[model samples]
Target chain A: MTATVPGVRRGAGPLPRALHPGAWWLWALCLAVVASRTTNPLLLACLIAVAGLVVARRRGDAPWALSFRMYLLFGAVIVVVRVLFRIVFGGGGGETVLVNLPEIPLPEAAAGIRLLGPVAAEEVLGGAYDGLRLAAMVICVGAANALANPKRLLKTLPGALHEIGTSVVVALSVAPQLVESVGRVRRARRLRGGVGRGRRAVRGILIPVLEDALSRSLALAAAMSSRGYGRTGAVAGGRRALVGTLVIGGLLGVCAGLYGLLDGSAPPALGLPLLLGGLAVAVAGLAAGGRRVRRTGYRPDRWRGAELLTVGSGLAAALVMHLATEIDPADIYPSLTPLSWPEVSALPLAAILLGLLPGYLTPPPPTSEVPA
Target chain B: MARRSVGSAALGALLALLAALLAPLSPASAAPGLARPAAGSAGFCPDASGVTVVVDFRELGGGRVVRCAHGPQADGLAALRNAGFTVAGTNRWGDAFICRINGRPGVDSEPCVDTPPSTAYWSYWHAGDGENWTYSQRGATYRTPPEGSFDGWSFSLNQEEGSAPAPGLAARRPSDGGGSDGPGGAGGDQGGAGGDSGGPGAGADPGGAAGGGSSPGGPGDAGELPPDAESDVEDEEREEEAEEEPDEEPDEDVDDDRSAEAAPLPTEDAEWSGTDEEFEEQSAARDDSGGPSAGTVATLGLLVALLGAGGLTAWRRRRAAAASTAGAGADERPADER
Candidate 1:
């Protein structure tokens, strides 16, 4: 952009340009929604596999990018904890007893409550399925985080939301920076040969790390201010109020609209019309807000054909899943009592597979952009 | 005198209601002939007027059905048995598969099928208001059918067959009990099967056995045996059961709770002596057929996949860290030289 060249190529191949961060987020959200539609472990497994494959293939070599494994670790912990809770609470109904804990008979007052007794296989299974579904959604979010550049994503936000977006980008960068600071302090202490045992070790590492963090944060704040962080030009008070009202009102409308959109059982009056109204109000708010904040752009990101294709696949997956719920709600939470194969429809399954389209169509992240 | 009689009658009725509520498993005094206490469910299907039970003798060439108001039976199996279907089962898979209906048993060609069944046998399903059938996960004895729906027994020949096929024959429409009293349940006369044993005590009985015993013949000959020989066997069994029937002795003392509870009609001990209380105790029963949840198996696979991906990521991170540290050492030497 500084060189004033259009479509400049560093390499001769198609894999030179990085994918739009919006595309990654949109793709991940679509896959997460699909995971929510079914408790069928088979379908959920397929979904998790798709997400893992895509994230692995597309993620760049960045500190934030390395955090996806931590998400998986969190998911495993969630599943194990869920199963453990089931063992503790659920029993009495199912016949197949895996383990029999001591049955403490409560007084008649606690009629329905059972404590540490036989753990049923059915309960454990149900818990695992539920936990897996939730973990899948969480990891999908993590995948979006790993693959998308937080700073790049902040740029794509509407002007009205820029301040909020910037703060979020800063907050995300803090954890990795803190880890780097700790590593540096530890190495310095080792070189000085003063990392004493117990209390002495704590004083050696803790004070320097805290001091470093404070100084770095102050430096960052100074840099941001010098670069004109909040330099919106003087505006009429009425216009400011109107802009605030439009954004606030638009946000409330969007929340209500989203509630209606996600819940199919909600009334028609509360659904499509409200969602459309919210979107319209939000757009108007963004346009008004964009006028006041003036900043030089080094080449605004383009919404290319590939971006549309990438996001569309995800949208299609989510939309098809919502459609599937309307068609047969039973297919979602498959019953264990009857012991039949959880119904997996061809259309929804195909849509879930289609969600993987972004991995192929978008250009892979170039190694040069990654920090050494 | 009229006032006193009314008071006594009311007290007796109150005592009966009190006993019924207290016992939870007490048969209604109004219909004594209905042996088992009926557990009432709010019938969901508004359109369905009355109960129509269909019995399908799959691979046995024929089946039979009985139409009745929701009657007294301990559970669904007892309900079918009281309706005169000779149901058979092993110690395992309680009522999962009905081996016999109307004396026909499963053979080499035909098996008593279970759904996702290991063998070629029949599976029982109860249609609870909905058109779709629920394969009974709980034993029929534990679950009663919501009235006005169909309880079907279908034999699955193979694993791949369209599951839970309805009985071949249509359920018979409700009968008017005709001349032969068709289980009209003449509660006082205590007629029907038990009355057919015709003791001299029953002959002198004040209430006439008015209704005829009008049970339908099996569509299959049911291996028709000589009636004379069968009657003697039935008579011996009935006499033995009659001895075991409750309300045998009425106590004069009203204060004893046990006497009040045991006695069906304290005023008339004579009637209960002949009345057969069909209380089939499901003795020494344990459910043995359940397996590990199939969905859990799939989730375990999902968990394994997540762990594997995580391991790969960790391995790559360690390698990258090693290379970067080695380079940092090289860069430190250059800085010292400069």
Candidate 2:
């Protein structure tokens, strides 16, 4: 049985190990950045495909790993809702009328806002493009969730954020834990020959599941407290205040910087310079605060060549998309007035293909002993 | 079995709903010929029966192109469109916010995907004959320009609402050829100086000359003559016309000199004629014509290929897991018995 297990077999390949969670997050974020830049359905579809492929090839047998489909379903829902809204709201005034729904007249107070007007192909296509961009962004984040181990990610959080990380990890795990608890309660009920249906069955399962989850959380909290998980070493109040100020001020600067960068009319000084300065200050603050929480890792995930390759490929994809935006914005944002087919240029397509590097380059995920 | 049946029923209902929605879709008439107003000469409308559309390319550098939207137009947007110039609206605001005129400030300068920054945008103005330009409170789509009124669009860059430059040409119609030439000629010369010193010299000349009561001569200079020797043609026409109509001949000469200085612009005005068909064709080419290009096909193929690869990997992984689970179950049972 041990020999049959691929992970346990010797000399099969490089010993399977999970890549750094941060690398996956950075890579996914870069892909999301690429998604935000363009409304071209073709490019967005390419991005979605690349993300799905990576997630399929690299996701482990974990509860979160199975949630990518949920994200895809959610993305589809977004697209449907967006298109529906366009149909209802006059379809952005195009000549190519698709569906002439009866126009609903509103009171004089709600002038300029139409309801149930003629739907145009341009409007529907515009909504799809906008929705696809958003969906691509969501799926990229989902890909990261599936590819990276949330527990490992929590462990890798800065020492200053240990308490916050603990809360986040618990919150992240709650859905899966609730699902497990419900399953266990259902199985127990079935074993006892209680085949109640609907409301009664829900009542029977819900209470026990809640009780089980509460007890499990209590036990986890107790274990963590005993292990000194969130212990803060002696730190001066003045130092703590300074760190807080730095962080808050830095965050404010970052917010302003991002606003400036996104708004076309904003002054140039408020953009890149402010963003870089804020980042530097935030990093310094984090480092200072980290010293107060004296903690060590058992087996820390190292930033290896695989991690570099993963993050670099993501950055390359983002860079290429940005370049494409500059070089051929017309292709990136296809005109919808006449309702033309969305097209993707070669460079941007190749850049999105580069996003597939980590799936092939990184070592395969360690297989779980339990079948999923 | 119950769950599968329920799912299939829901899908069938969805399909039915889709069919119902699609049933109302009539075959769209391809490229409907829109009611476009006839292209007019550079000045205000020759009479009160039309709406003159003045597009001032301020800072964008093309000078003003005044075209008349003939007939009774419904609204400012309709008039602008009818005047044979192309108008592009922002994606977010639809026709509420005018983003481009005749494709000025190209996509590189302004993407037109969203509400343009307030600092740089086309400011709409309205004026009655001989009245000062007033900033319009309502959007172009909402406001109806009265026949013989002026609908102006000036590109406002880094200017406040109060300071936003109106169209350089004043709202003065051409005088009815006889005694009105005194005030009209004075207005024309003032407009000429304003046009010459501020931006391009050509836009103001025709308006000036037309207002000066030599309206026929001004149109003849711009429309009848070729672009290269427009100034010479204007001089010869001015001399001959001056001989025939000596009353406003001096004003026509002064206007001709200014028009001569900015001669190339009149050629543009002449070329701008018959743009309605061209504009429609351009839009049709952009919107309807092209099938998917090679790049689009390649992108779609790549997407499909990736999806297929991903599906294959998932299938292979599921099969491997099933095999491993069977092997593990057999080994565990034997060990338990032992």
Candidate 3:
């Protein structure tokens, strides 16, 4: 296949040389953080669309990539389910009533709980806003799943995490592989006699699927071992214990720091310092662990200018949303009273639009298969 | 005369209970004066030149006081802030867990209502025409007061046991609920305040609702201005006030015609808090006048544009896939033919 775009070197080895997989995860994470920062639907929608565009533009012809549509469908379901829950459980008192369900009075003990009460516009809007934020987050995770090859991403992990990353990568790849396996078996069975129903067919299909998964897992284990997977240098017991302690302590500090930043009730001291100290300790542990791992990679992925730009776009979106929330919190959490249009600020919205840059700026993913 | 004295004596006892209950909060509120400055006036509303907010501090012993403040669209929380009363609350229920109104905390006490327990929390009520109070169905953040109203707040100690009672306050004007309540023309004078005698609520509303709250000359001018025939015209203004939230959200006609900035400001009605209300009114004005400010428009525009780009990307990918497949089929056909 001929390269159509200028400045994209065909000598960059076969068209569509894979992007640094870490770039995709970083980008998706940034988009997710932006979604979490605001309840504004318009901003969230833009973030979702940008993710969708990037996924569509760059995603390889892989089953994991195809799963993006599933995320979108799931997002729609979440919104509908959230609204339904609000309709079923929401009590009266919101000014704008969309639908009033018959109220069922309960015993005094059930005072706060309302069943089948008026479904107000406010409740629906609130639910939809909340659902949309959650859906945006889910979609970001899905975009990362769809765009980045999990095995490729695992390859870029620190040497200390190499063994763990491989198992995780294999575990993730199994779902998509299982889906493909099931499809293949079904098609083969259809060729024989349009898959018969009842106990016989269930037995036939279940046996094959389980057998296929076992064989696949064995093959994966064999392949991993053949690649000199267990290679490690000797380390003193005391030093190993120290590394473990630092790693565990750092993880706890990070957890505490994260909770402090996200929760208004947590103490002030647990926030920045704890996060920094935890990160410092975790890095030290990672460095120590790396020394014990005697391993090399095949053509390790380079972090180039394009990779930085891709990651930066996502971080930029998150930073912009942070500034917006700081400047005007009211727009982020609009009032539901006297129901009117919730105001959206230009700066934050502009920032979200900035996420669209990678969709256009990065070289388009080369089609994997040669057409002619 | 003996029965009236007994009633007054009961009222006096209730006040002492209220004052004692309020003792915890009075330090923070530094409440202007508990001593009834006059027989029927004091506490927030000096007299009834504006809307009277009745604080039924039931947990702090139930008695009510009248305070003048902005209506709900202007944020009733601002009313507490305006009166120099500090309110402690959690945003958990969006400012609904108002544990302390002034310094008296309803939570973390000896009986300890941990955070937001339903048994002992602040409940809200409102009285329109200053007659009978109605429970505010929604939380304070979402429920702005309707036209010509009195705001009531009560701290229910044990609402789980039974219904919380409205604070039996003497400040409430005795209700002879007739005449003035008629459509559109409620803006006209009632000729007499009746049992309320110097009733601030009745005295204040027409001037306030008709857009006169901004001007101090509001009440006296509304009192004398064509009390009989031109009453319905005042009702038309009051009717606009009836749909005031809608009135506030949109620009020009209601505001310009209402502002009447020119020609000596003819007894401006609508009990607007002027400064705070004007700031909110300006925001609303920007929204209504320009259809939407640049921020909203850009947000919407960017959203649509990004979605469109996503669709375009999908389309381009599809076309590329088709072209490649077609190219492959053409090449394969020749090889198979050979």
Question: Model 1's DockQ?
Answer: 0.03
Which of the numbered candidates is closest to the native, going by highest TM-score?
Answer: 2
Better model by DockQ: candidate 2 vs candidate 3: 2
Return the lDDT, model 2, position B150: 72
Global lDDT of each candidate? 0.51, 0.65, 0.54
Name the candidate that leads on lDDT.
2
In candidate 2 the C-alpha lDDT for residue B258 amounts to: 39
Let me know the TM-score candidate 2 reaches against the reference structure.
Answer: 0.77
Residue B187 lDDT in candidate 3: 19
Estimated TM-score for each candidate: 0.56, 0.77, 0.61
Tens digits of lDDT, candidate 1, A282-332: 889888987887656567768887788889999998888777666655446
Better of 2 and 3 by lDDT: 2
> How well does each candidate reproduce the native contacts, as fnat?
0.01, 0.35, 0.23
Which candidate, 1 or 3, would have the higher lDDT against the true structure?
A: 3
Better of 1 and 2 by TM-score: 2
**B109-199 in candidate 2: lDDT tens per residue?**
7777777877788878765544435567667877778776678787877765345555555455444331123354454454344332211
For all candidates, the clash counts are 5, 1, 18
CA error at residue A335 for candidate 2, angstroms: 1.5
lDDT of 2: 0.65
Model 2's DockQ score: 0.21
